[model samples]
Target: MTLLTPPGVYTPQADTALLAEALRDEAVPPGAQVLDVGTGTGALALAAARRGARVTAVDISWLAVLTARLNARLAGLPVRVVRGNLLAPVAGQAYDLILSNPPYVPARAATPPRHGAARAWDAGHDGRLFVRRICREAPRLLRPGGVLLLVHSALSGPEASLRELRSAGLKAAVAARGFIPFGPVLRARRAWLDAQGLIEETETTEELVVIRAERPV
Candidate 1:
């Protein structure tokens, strides 16, 4: 599907595809309420809408919000696009499924970028700035039996995410995994990752995992 990705908006890629695949596997009941956090191009939200779910997509970037809304319109999908930090705009709302392909790229920045295209992918030094936040806050936005599907590189600590969600009283596990060659961001930071002992000098590929965390029914 052709999506209009404005200059500062994030383009959906492999991680997006992975999460979409997992969403397809989910048994989202008809009329299920779904939330897509960081819905860059509205890919996941549109997918859920196509599956007969009531979808709401959130993004911190206005450009992304506009792009996603345009895509949804073009696709004739009913996705409510909102611009705000993760889970904040949907406060007090509960969803049956929450999808996210948040920023998980380890970067030199101590915190995620406040502006620019880098904000789409540049997380903290450990690459868990947004991932950790999602794990902590998303659970509360879920209804009983709700599920959170999040995709990120293993370098960002999938185990840490599982632990966090479980500690928050959700049953969490790796739902899917894919290995792909390093993208530009990871390639550029290869040296630093190696220095930080996060990756081997010879490593040219990174594994992305879809973490499924479910609130007990």
Candidate 2:
């Protein structure tokens, strides 16, 4: 599905596709309440809506929120697109499924970009800023037996996510993985990544993993 990604909004990429694939493989019962945090281009939310789920998508960027709303309207899907920080707009609500492909690219910046397209991918020095936050908070937003599907590069520490989620009392494990060649952002950060020992100097591929965590019934 083609989406209109305006400037300053994140464009869906391979990580988005990986998360969407995980969403497709999951059992999304009809009328299930679904939430897609960091819904860049609304790709994952649209996927859930296609499966007959009632979907809400959240993004921190106004441009992304507008783009997602437009894309959902154009696709004839009833998706609620809200602009706010991750998972903030839907506070006090529980969902059967929560999805996210948040910013996980390790960067030199101590904090993610406050403005600009880089906010879509530049996480803190270890790339776990948003990932860890999701692990901590998403479980509370999930109904019993609900699942959270999150995608991020292995460089950002998949095991850390699993540990964090399990500590939050959810069962977590890797659901899917794929090796993708370095994209523009990763390519530009190759030197720093290698120096930080996050990647090999000669390595060109990064493994992206979909982590599925379930709130026990």
Best by TM-score: 1
- Measured with C-alpha atoms, the lDDT of residue 201 in candidate 1 is 90
Per-residue alpha-carbon lDDT of candidate 2 for residues 37-88, written as tens digits (9 for 90 to 100): 9997898999999999999999998888899999999999999999988988
Query: What is the C-alpha local distance difference test score of candidate 2?
Result: 0.93
Per-residue lDDT for 119 in model 2?
A: 90
In angstroms, give how far residue 165 of model 2 lies from its true place.
0.3
Clashes of each: 0, 0
Off by over 4 Å in 2: none
Report the CA-based lDDT of candidate 1 relative to the real structure: 0.93
Candidate 2: clashing pairs of residues? none
- Model 1: per-residue lDDT, tens digit, 125-164? 9999999999999999999999999999999999999999
Off by over 4 Å in 1: none
What Cα-based lDDT does every candidate model obtain? 0.93, 0.93
